[model samples]
Target: MWLKNLNTIFVVGYPIFVSIIWITGGLFSSFYRHRQSRKLLTADEEPFVSILIPAHNESDTLVAAVKSLAGLQYQHYEVVLIDDCSTDNTWELMETLAKQWAGQLAIHNLHLPINQGKASALNQGAKIAKGDYLVVIDADSLLQPDAVTQLMTTLLENPNYGAVTGKPIVRNRSTLLGRLQLLEYVAVIDLIKKAQAYLTGSITTVSGVIVAFRREALNEVGGWNPAVMTEDIDITWRMYRNKWQAAYEPRAVCWILVPERLRGLLKQRQRWSRGGLEVLITNRRGLYLNPWGQRGLLLESIVSNCWAILTAISLVAYAFQLFFLHNLSLDGNLLILMFTLNAIQFTIGFIASQEIAQLTLPELLLVPVYILYYWLINLVSCIAAISSYFVDPQRRGTWRSPDRGL
Candidate 1:
């Protein structure tokens, strides 16, 4: 009798324990690095920065997007908006913005005779970028006033920090969905990133909206390639392998629009998922038992991505216990306690993210219950990965933001 329910405990408890372990390690690591990141704020001789904006057809918000950057406190910078063969009036918009901010922003209005993709567009923009640092942002994103100054200052203080990412706040989060994203943004834009900072100071992904890297660093990797679906992630990994550490400065924030509708959300998530898989497949060697780079960061990435597989194994054991083992009567107290523990963990995440301004109160509270809603993203990503594995898109250089552009 005692042994009958033992299988259930073993099935669930182990994975839960493992998840806690992962979070705990990340949390402690983050706590330590938060201090280090803060110290990377020495008065910089505001480095020259070339802001890269690659758009397909972001006619709706491209002007406002450029306006945010045009007024950066750091006077030594240029905004280069690349037009990636848009059928819309996006090129016209870029032309207008270029002239309007003529001296301040050196607009690299590029229309690849054919639509190559964001990767190509960024490469094109980077080729002409004449700044000490290269900063990339999406068309729907806007930077904070001090964003440029903060980023350069951070790097100036931390010479070892090859790339520094700013915080991403969900802009136009007026709707329920938008509000949800705004709420969720805080956790991701801050806490988790903070955790990633200490674990290896080598985050696997960087927000395109606001990430600045040394020009030489990008040159070292030979620029963005179409092969890497998620050019941002690919670049981050490359920086790590090349012994370039990354830092996250939540103080430098950018407001970005989230996919307003479900369809848009799916497309956006699919792209991210597809890109993640592509990154993993291409850089698997660099991350796993590689001779180069810091060991801790590689280990963290491997564990995080491999968590899905680890969870799958536990679920399999749970299925067997319930069906074949006929262990229909598991202890209620144990189950309750285990779930409550998970609840506490989720609460901590909610509290952490919420306190850090990443998630809304409701989103944090609802994170567990919204399994069907959010889990679909994981499923879709898996699907995208499968699709990419078989039929790789024709080096489609342009990345269509989930809801915006062509």
Candidate 2:
């Protein structure tokens, strides 16, 4: 009876609980906006914003990225381009772009002598930035015309908002892996971010692709940490502990290229997993002694980690039980029920993303298969990341672009 009850909780009850959170959080994210006017602030009225684009071996995509920035409708902003010792001709391309958009766009170009990773590059950019707010954009991403303007408006409206991160929709879906990633982004990443925002008034991470931060809030937290695999996650936690708020703006859209092969995808996921584990370890103390309304987020993180471990153990136990009972069945009632609930979860995610990203019908159709694919990959990645965190003390927190699909 106890085993049956545990199976029900894991298979049905937990998913229902998760779905409720997702639905309400999605609604809040979709409709909840500041009471201020919807209009984008004009140049004379708004605060100056520094747009930082950090590049490394991005010659192939630099031109398009700069061109997208050039088309921005925001007036009071400057582009600070940091070339992080690219071996390719990225510097030359950046120089050309700087000259071409010289007067039309205020461009500051800096070249590092050696590749110091993204965190160091961003820190360098922040130090010299003149704007009250700093906007970080990856060189490989293309921001919408009003992306910067929207982010700034959102940040300025709330005095406590330390940072605001934009939505990153995958742009490269030419390959099968890419298509799978598209579904994962909309169904998993986006949903969780919205839910986190709604539940805690904070998010787990400010996406590295495109995020804006108030200069003072960043300075208070000592800028960005260089030792973590993900600077974004590290900074978010710092802001939280420092009593600053982080927000997610779904309307602020940035298109990003995703890895389109299995190897590249796995590497990206592993890097994310390692970064999360690093944050968990670093913040272990804070999780125990919560301060200044930080207990909710702290408890959430601890629970999430515990849940992952328990889920893994439960699956192994269930497998052994089935084998011992000689009652293994693929077409069981529990399997069908679980599948239906997952399908409902996917549909809710698809509809939410469609409302935000304008996704097409065909992309929505792929959610069922993509859900299973991503679950297995994510589980394996989490296990690998946990092992690395404990056993591999020599691992360097570095950044390298994943393989671009053919």
Candidate 3:
């Protein structure tokens, strides 16, 4: 009876396909990014750039974020900080910075009557921007002095490149949770970003931490959709569809403060996962029209991620069924052996190969814990997707809070 049902469940429940999708998709991306990173423009061509930062109740960290930009190696730049009607001192803080910099920094403060989202603030900033290039940055994020120079240099040196994503180093790596997030950050943003850069011309979300776009591209794409929860992702898809190319020049570095606690990290990840589902769904037209979209984006995205969620969920459900409900039966030894072999294969074949240098023996020893975290994050992503299903334009405060630096 069990072997009979195994056929049905194996077809539905076997998560091997999920691993294959991620691995192959990841390999393509990683290979492409490797080549791109190897080839870069050595010549220096700095274009005047406009930095658009949206702030909301960021008084605690806004000044540092703004001041950090002043140190940029690329001197031709303007800093426009939008105070998106914060009840906090973020506005007053920006006022002080504006006064201190005076003529040295081209600073403009647009205080919204009420709280609007980051997209709206960015649209307003882009309207009055006085530069050939525009960069969207988060308040809590700080660009390295050379980050803008490298990113803008990529655009100036290569006219074909549409946008560039800067390398983001975790700022809060003090606590164990922070350290764990830091590792996760490397795995996701650093490693995965490299893959996207290589494969499919669609590097979906450039970190709000630091992403630069050509003025023409941003204007052509029409600023950002105030209604789009993840305007960053929306713009990327539009850019790709319009035939513009995006690049990942890791030389562009930005420091960002990750959540110190697991719960805070969960909220941020949940927001991103939910927001990403919105992006993938919203751009279904572009994905479907192109044949590669089926294998590359739509089918791969929906099927692969859905299975990842199901795998994590099923593992727990089976445990409950076997222990409490006594509704499922299996060879515990074979099952344990099966997972142990798969775990070893996955870590050594992939995780170790990619993160070996950074993930020490002790860190590698923590793979089991990391897997739990990974599953939790994926489950949260599914929840976020479910949430997006119910709320199209989910109203969660202003879309992009003022850069008071959260």
Candidate with maximal TM-score: 2
What global local distance difference test value does model 1 have?
Answer: 0.67
For candidate 3, the clash count comes to 11
In model 1, which runs have C-alpha deviations exceeding 4 angstroms? 1-44, 103-108, 287-372, 390-397, 404-406
In model 3, the runs with Cα more than 4 Å from the true position are 1-44, 291-295, 312-316, 325-365, 391-406
True-vs-predicted CA distance for residue 316, candidate 1, Å? 10
Better of 2 and 3 by TM-score: 2
By descending TM-score, how would the candidates be arranged? 2, 3, 1
Maximum-lDDT candidate: 2
Minimal lDDT window, size 10, model 1: 367-376
Tell me the lDDT of candidate 3. Answer: 0.66
Which tens-of-lDDT digit does each residue in 95-156 have in candidate 2? 89999999788988888887878999999987777898899988878998889888988898
Worst 10-residue lDDT window for candidate 2 reads 327-336
* lDDT (CA) per prediction: 0.67, 0.79, 0.66
TM-score of each: 0.80, 0.90, 0.81
Residue 85 displacement (Å), model 3: 0.6
Instruction: Spell out the clash pairs found in candidate 2.
Output: none
- Residue-level lDDT of model 1, residues 70-150, one tens digit each, is 777777777787888888899888878878888777676766666777888888888888887988888888887888777
